[model samples]
Target: MAEPLSSLSLWPIGNCQVSALIDDAAGLVWGCVPRVDGDPTFCALLGGERQDEGVWRLRLAGQVSATSQYRRNTPMLVTRLEAEDGSAVDVIDFCPRYQHSGRMYRPVAFIRIIRPVAGNPRLEMLLTPMHHYGTEAARTTRGTNHKRFLIGDHQLRLTTDAPIGYIDEGRSFRVEQDLHFFLGPDEPFTGNVAHSIRAMEEATELYWQSWVRGLATPMDWQEAVIRAAITLKLCQHEETGAIVAALTTSIPEAPHSERNWDYRYCWIRDAYYTVQALNRLGALDVLEKYLAYLRNIVDRAAGGHIQPLYSVMGFAELEESVAANLAGYRGMGPVRIGNAAWTQIQHDAYGQIVLPTVQGFFDQRLFRMADERDFESLESVGEVAWKMHDQPDAGLWEFRTRQLVHTYSAVMSWAACDRLGNVAERIGRPERASFWKDRAAKIRARIEAEAWSDEKQHFGAAFGHHHLDASLLQMVELRFIRADDPRFQSTFAAIEMALRRGEHMLRYDSEDDFGQPETAFNICTFWLIEALHMCGRSDEARGLFETMLAHRTASGLLSEDLDFESGELWGNFPQTYSLVGIINCAGLLSRSWDTVR
Candidate 1:
């Protein structure tokens, strides 16, 4: 029988370096190695009908049903499979991450422990890995207790205690005892495999639980917030402190929309929102590391210019191309590898840099405080924001063929100058504060005159247009305007009437390069919820929040897009933008701690 196709109903496990997606049946479907943006070592999620090639699965003979769940407050996943004859087996999966050798030990490895719990069971281990974007199978070599797969120039070794002959020949065997498998670098295993794996599992669990314990979670929806927060952390590349937008690439925004693009790289705009959301939970570790990444980016720019996105290693050139060998999500063609948006001129990036960097000056808890030298570097970013406030460029949405002075971009530019002024004042640079505040005032006046649509009675998507966009709602969140301000209220009313589709919200109603969008962007819906709460519609906001929460997958996570009509998830898995929305909204709408105290 053929294996079933993959879906968004998957769980994520990572250690801030390498990550993988597992299906309910405990198949390792998607993962990248060396780094998040590296080659897909397990490309089964986009492998189409040929998924049996690039995947690792433990098959239970006569399998009847299966169930899976994450260990509470951690990314460790436990899956149980029951056979027709009442036989069962438990599969515990995780990537090792703990304190070892006086440093954080996070290797690019996957650990699986399988133990039979019920009647005598038979198991078939299918561990076929592919190379070069699923174009060919990985060549294999064997040892006494392990097998090595030559993938591209690198080799991945599978060190297992299971019957090596059975796994090597893809044969079914009796599950008479516990089994352990470690797939990682081609190195010798020193310690006893069983004992080392068990100890790693315990330490990894403790590491995650202790991290979660330190979070200042809200009074309500604590579980949901923690899951989302962990998912966001999984998206970050700790070595570089860069947070990616999503884990997979080329998952269409809608069925056959052809709007697929790679999302493994870090977007300045996305990273800023990620740090802002994590900061609200007092997860300053992420913020502090991200600030370091931001400082490097700003220094490289020399306060002149910055790209919208970059590779996880902070490299600039990410030439876009298609991997025709592998099929896309659900056999959709054209799986993209690198993102072209890295070259687009997204003016909002300046603000994204300044917004998060300014936090370092105010937060006293960070290990390294921002000094005058840091402020000097930030002013270079502010200068660019002031210069580009009204310049036409690609908007945050990255419209390929159009260039416009977008309202969102201009607003962010204004925010850049505005925040620089605050930082200057905090650092006792009153003269610098006055200078930036003046520029901010001028930019605000220009936006008020150009972006506002007099005929539509609302702010437009871009200057001198009457189009409604979900991003306009961000004005309130960015403090560009108060919720009660008449202009903002009118803009909100216009947007609600135009972009709201039942419980979901569209990024914009206007057609784009790919025609009209067929699915709702998840972050846009959360933006509407935030707007509703800010407008004093607490009941409406709470109800809508509940509806959104109900849309999360069994793993309590969401993707980048959703089929508003069917509520099925689409786009990439474990979207950082969507997860950030969960954290921000929960902090906003959850019951106050005073209620319980």
Candidate 2:
């Protein structure tokens, strides 16, 4: 039987195409195939209490304990499982992704290399894949050296050097030699299994290390920044250049809160933050590809409407549904599939699109520079931003119950017009620059007049309300207000008073659609840290950042939320937003290289 779906202590391995979540015991608990938003082939992560199937586990007979870590700068995970007799086995897991032919060759494949490192080890291989969101097991057939799993027009073939019969029947066998397993598309692997996999591993390691070598990492917390950067890269679907919010869906924000929602789709707001953080690290490849995705989205919008989220393939309309078959994370139930928020009105998206697009106009290292035609396309999005600057929508938190002119949304709209003005000036269009700058000024004036609350001496969550939220801290980051401005300082102080919970910070203290959030939003906490630094509280910001770093999982990554009191990670696995926070905070707080040099 597979182990029960336990904690969020999971490690992610991917190739920018597909990803998997491996538990501490080296079990492949959750993985979606073909793409990040596809079916959950390994769905044991949500298989309720005591998952019996839908997992791929290399079990060591008489296993005592297991420990796992990443391979330095890459997503290649190395897990060491020790038996009671001191015999141990090292399980190396990775998805094959490296440069090949004349282009990048990232296939939908997973590779596992098992080697005995200590005394004689006994191994049991259990490969069970589920179909249709864990409703049924994938029917299997076997050959002499490979096993094929059939799932509704799609097939996955497992080519291995281990005894096929042993794996098919789930029997324990003594491991006297190394074994390699390649589970990928339903096609023949063209060479010697052992030699080809080893070469792929070496090439993949080289690819990631070389990529890391090019990063402009911070002087301190370099490892944490690198890990977070790699995790963000994994969340991106390179085929379309769209980045998902998180790898898995239905991992509740707070346990039993029924607040679970699918995060596998691309959010314009999230991707903007992602590109911004990655751009800080000098990772332009991701920025270039993501800009391509944004252009497509802008072109499709045709200067009018824009959604908050879209499928990784640029498709709209994600009808949210529940997976009745799977029990949920830790048996919490109501495993959701698609996101309903894609249909909601999130006016902040216009600014998100413009914020990242503006970078393309000025950056010289990019292969393709933004031209007049690109600016014209961006103007359409800017028009929407102007139209919706004061309009009510779902806001950034996606409140399902009410609609209001959120301060964050209006500020983002202002940022859109503001950046367009900058882009226009960069492209030598003084007339257009003046037009956008005027609109931005008008929006800024309105925000300053209405969003401030004299009663509470802080900016409200919405235009006329006095409720405080952590997103108000974005005023400095978005350039809406000077950090030293008295109003912003007062706003920051008021937000800290209401939302600060010990070392963590909440998105808000009041009730929302979910009856008050039960945990601290990870990215919100990072926003507070950034706000503290900007407010001239450098020491306090550094201390809080250290506390947040200490709360990351053993894999040096965070999810969407963290329990304030217990410090346990909750929400979806490998959240791009939380990972972006790590990179951004590290870059902001790290000492200058001159000091170290």
Candidate 3:
């Protein structure tokens, strides 16, 4: 049995906490538990050193093959096996979530193990736990039985009443036959499969089914789109509403190109889109949780300014440190920890936060004068945007090389002012309304005058440069300009000519004279799809949408970028923003088609 490079071959069936994939030929079950940051516990995508942090592998014999699916909407995964010897086995896995009593909480994370019917098929199990992001080794000890190991400040307890056999390694263990593993901070690990496994299987089936039934999606792309949404929801930090950019880090931006970047932290820009997508799906509970996170950002910033990204726990000032000791995935050098884009004046971030905040107030009717807390949140965001209106920013791409007065940044700055004006008027805040409206108008005039290039007759990447950028696709998506506007057409043409790579597009080409061009960004491509829809190119837009969908991996996963020449995914696997953008863009394009038809 061998591992297939295609993700489509891996079956996906799990809840927000963990998604399990089964390899039929290998008879191996793989699962990913969303971490506080973006990385997964089982990182088979990264390979070698980045293979997996915590693993549970079971080997089945007798020429057995497997098939699996989720137990409804619950996190429970069920894999069925049939062997040549006419034996069958049902393997179920699930982590009991914090959702109960109509609320979700953290800690006491539970992973239930169940085997409904053992077909007397021989199976071998292996469990491994790596510490400090797979950088350090740990010690293992046992109290006469159960496999117990401690790493750093945490202890893992593996308990199974099954006839468990063990093979000892220095830091890990290889278990045989029927056994179970549990990991946590303090709880003594225990699992009695004989009785508990059956109960767990039934309970898990009911849980997921109930969850799926509660969803209110419009039912257009229910299967693939909802699955993508569920995957994004799972990537969220349960303790905090902060969502990560992806579940794995250091999967090179280009194959062997030294372009890998850590995408674990919460990006303010990503959160804005996430709110829109979730709100449209009627997932108000999740939306409000994220709004609470946003309010926390405003309270902490206090008009000083907010970082573009933050830790899962809302910690700002992400230090871009590297883990020098650990061997990187497939020898990709200098694995990064924190993001340096936090402090830069990516002025587009201002609009990212403000636009969604305004949308919340308007669309959801979330703000009221009587609610002091809501007013405070709006005021905090408005005041910050007003203060930073004139400052230079790094722009939408968050270019690592230099800071420039990016045209996209100006567009967002103007948007922030525009949204504040609208929200203030709605809430009868005259003072704020008048000031923001005037500010927005002035910013708009300046953007048209300064960001445009007379020589090229198109929008420039920044205030002075001649280069174009796909970020301007947002100009139409955000309603900054109408689809029929001649200026938009010219700008779109320039961007298509310059940034488009094959069927996809990029943020902007580098300012330098040297080095090869990188792959087209996945998010920007969707931005183009939306722009096309708005421009009255519905047919073209739908064609592009299908083209983009074709790029999805075998398991319906997308990366941050794609190699233009080779058609291989570059950057992290299953990028959250990319998938979310696809869903949103597809929805918009479909609606446009319906309207035109």
Q: Write the per-residue lDDT of candidate 1 for residues 57-169, one digit (tens) a residue.
A: 88799999889999999999999989999999999999999999998899989999998999999998888888888888889999999999898887888998899999998
TM-score of each: 0.99, 0.99, 0.85
For model 2, residues 176-215, the per-residue Cα lDDT tens digits are 8889999999999888999999999999999999999999
Model 3 Cα lDDT, one tens digit per residue, 1-597: 233332323444444444444443322233333344532334343334433334445545553577766554543556765668755556665554545567643332334353435456655555555555555545677654456666556565655564434434322232234344344334554455445544544655665566556665543555656666666776667567777787556667765576667777788887777767766666665666676677778778846477888887899878877656444555665567677778777667778777766656655444321243565566666666666665677666676667777777788778888887887787788897888889888888877888787789887877777877787777776777887888888988888888887778887776432246578888888888887777778788888888878887654657788777777777765678787876787578554335544
* RMSD to true structure for each model, in Å: 1.0, 1.0, 4.3
Task: Order the candidates by lDDT, highest first.
Answer: 2, 1, 3
Alpha carbon RMSD to native, model 2: 1.0
Poorest lDDT segment (10 consecutive residues) of candidate 2: 1-10
lDDT of each: 0.91, 0.92, 0.63
Q: Model 1: number of clashes?
A: 0
TM-score of 2: 0.99
lDDT, model 2, position 50:
45
